[model samples]
Target: MKREEFEKIVEETIESLPEEIKQKLDNVVFIVQDYPDSDELKKTKASKYNLLGLYTGIPLSKRGTSYGMYPATPDRIFIFKANIERICRNEKELKTKIREVVLHEIGHYLGMSEEEVRKALGE
Candidate 1:
């Protein structure tokens, strides 16, 4: 799929999120990259070809009173376009996979661990 179409799906998926979830997503940025970089692969310990998304920076739940006293980078959620496309064979599958990857990363941004996020997703 084209990057434009893929990005549009991502935007639509985010827009479809619950109002409460959307409201709490302050100081966060969504990025689309074709693949994971070497550093990201090492940090997440994930292989390059299969990793669908990643969340970086401090999670909201881990913040304390002093959190915003200094300038801070916004949390990042990276959606891996090529990797997602690799696993999905059709547009419907692509859309479903994108939503899953997005929601999974968002769970991490919200301070849920991998296990916690999986459980919440009934995985």
Candidate 2:
């Protein structure tokens, strides 16, 4: 999918989230990039076809009383349009996979483990 379309999906997904989860996203920014930088891809340890999205910043689990003393820089969730497109054969598959990827990355921001996300999604 194109960058514009991918970004739109990210926006739509955020808007469609449950109120509780949406409320927690107030400080995060959603960004769509063609692909991650080399270092980012390495950190994610993703296969050439594996990485579809990423979350970068202090996760909720890492925040504490000391964190409150510092000014917050917004957390970022980056969706890789090219990576997502590479694995999806059509619009329906793209949308579904994008939603899952986006949600999974945001779950990281909320301090969810992979197991937690899988259970939450009933995957």
Candidate 3:
């Protein structure tokens, strides 16, 4: 998908977030990039095609008492459309996957562990 279209999906996903989750998402920017940054790839130990999304910022738990007061200087979430599309077989699957990716990143922002994310998704 084009950057605009991918971004639209991401926006839609954000709009669909649960109220409780959305309430905590202030000041964070969501961006769609062609691929994950080198730092992210290194962190995740992901092959180029393995990662569909990345959250590059302080997790809520790690942010401690100053969570909201002391903002992350360069807070952002990066979603990789090309990598996602390369794995998905169709539009429906793509959208589903995109939502999953978006939510997974949001889970990170919300201080959910990877295991928690899987349970939330019923995976």
- For model 3 the local lDDT of residue 63 reads 68
In order, what lDDT does every prediction score?
A: 0.93, 0.83, 0.83
Give me the candidate number with maximum TM-score. 1
Better of 1 and 3 by TM-score: 1
lDDT of 3 by residue, 1-123 (tens): 677887898899999877887888866788887788777788797887788888878776676676667545755788888999998899889999999999988888778888998899886
lDDT of 1 at 115: 100
lDDT of 2 at 107: 90
Per-residue lDDT tens digits for candidate 1, residues 18-102, read 9999998978999999999997887787899879999998998998889889999998999999999999999999999999999
Q: How accurate is candidate 2 locally (lDDT)?
A: 0.83
Instruction: Give the lDDT of residue 47 in candidate 3.
Output: 81
Off by over 4 Å in 1: none
Where does candidate 2 stray beyond 4 Å? none
Ranking by lDDT: 1, 2, 3
lDDT of 2 by residue, 15-112 (tens): 99999989887468988887888867777777645677888888877887687577789888888888888888999999998899888988999999
For model 1, which pairs clash? none
